[model samples]
Target: MPLEKIKVIAFDADDTLWVNETFFRKAEEEFCALLEEYLPKEEANKLLFDVEMQNLPLYGYGIKPFTLSLIEAAIKISNGNMTIDLVQRLIEKGKAMLQEPIELIDGIDETLRRLSEKYRLVMATKGDLLDQERKLINSGLENYFHHIEIVSDKTEKQYKKLVKHLDITENEFLMVGNSLKSDILPVLNIGAHAFHIPFHTTWAHEMIDDKIDHPNFRSFAKASELLQIL
Candidate 1:
């Protein structure tokens, strides 16, 4: 199906607009190294991932929750023998991640600029609201989006609600993001068009092994290629 009917173009913020998963990957490496004395690097990584999955319900997603998970994992891995200095290093790592400069993906600014001219551009991202807002402001690309949504989660229900809130029919909305699980499947399931732009690094939680075939689903190697489809 052509995108002629798409009136609103929603973009995912993290890996789609700028660098995100890379920072998380780096943090995880640092965390693993910190706990290497207690457990093997591979084991430390597995334990941290488990802790993160468990804390998702209570802490949700973002650097802060991830930091907490790291601390928790450290304590558990070390049998409550974690040193104060190590805990402080973990905290500092999270802070550094939060303060990392917003690095826009190559051609993101130009792509968003071109799309904003023809469609009602909006940012649809899931994370801490304040952090999302801060990144948007610092990015200097916020003006391109007519509206922004920092959602708790991206489910079919959330997508449906968003369309209703935007007063647009499902067919009139198009979502673009890097994750097949969060950004593509949910939007397509809701009867909206979706474009998947794969980032170099992805969180394991967002990985999907099965193939997805739908008239409204498309994939691109990079965000700049969106211009060709739109």
Candidate 2:
């Protein structure tokens, strides 16, 4: 069905807007290499992923925990070879990931520009507040959004809160995002519409198990196609 009358167009940050996952992947590769002295590359990767999956609730999402995971993995594989210097380096890498602004996903600006003209574009994302804000500002896409939300988690409550704050109802709102947990599920749960634009890599912390059967649950093959519906 065509979303011919969309009013509030919301978005998820990170990979939805830019090349975020690739950085994490690169860091993960470097992280695995760091542990090669004690564990084979395959085993190091498996264990690191295992630890990340196990630490979601405790650490939540974003570079902080991913960095912590690297630190923990390095310590575990030290075999008496891990030193304070290595630990410091791991911390610095983590800080750099958050501090540095990666490139925006290709075609994001043109797509946002086209959509913004006809809808009340808003940013709806969850993460470290300051970090997410910095990414948006540095992205050079902040001006397009009239409202911005930096949430701790994505839930029906948060979706409704945006609706209430924006003075729009389910029919007028459309949440476009990459994560099923943070992007698609919550907004769709609140009787609102959503565009599920899948990313290549999804962080384990953002995983959610939910039934996706709704009239408003839309799917897209690319970010550029998002403008077609609006």
Q: Hey, what RMSD does candidate 2 come out at? A: 2.3
Global Cα lDDT for candidate 1 = 0.94
Task: Locate the minimum summed-lDDT window of 10 residues in model 2.
Answer: 72-81
What residue pairs are clashing in model 2? 18-105
lDDT of 2 at 165: 96
Q: What is the lDDT of residue 59 in candidate 1?
A: 94
What is the per-residue lDDT of model 2 for residues 1-230, given as tens digits with 9 covering 90 to 100? 44765688998888899878888888888877877878988888777888877777788667887888887777666755798888888898998898775698878899999888888899988777877888898999999999999877788988898899999778788988889887887777788888888888877656777668888887887899876656
Q: Tell me the whole-model lDDT of each prediction, alpha carbons only.
A: 0.94, 0.83
Question: How many clashing pairs in candidate 1?
Answer: 0
* Top-lDDT structure, candidate number: 1
The model with the greatest TM-score is: 1
> Which pairs of residues collide in candidate 1?
none
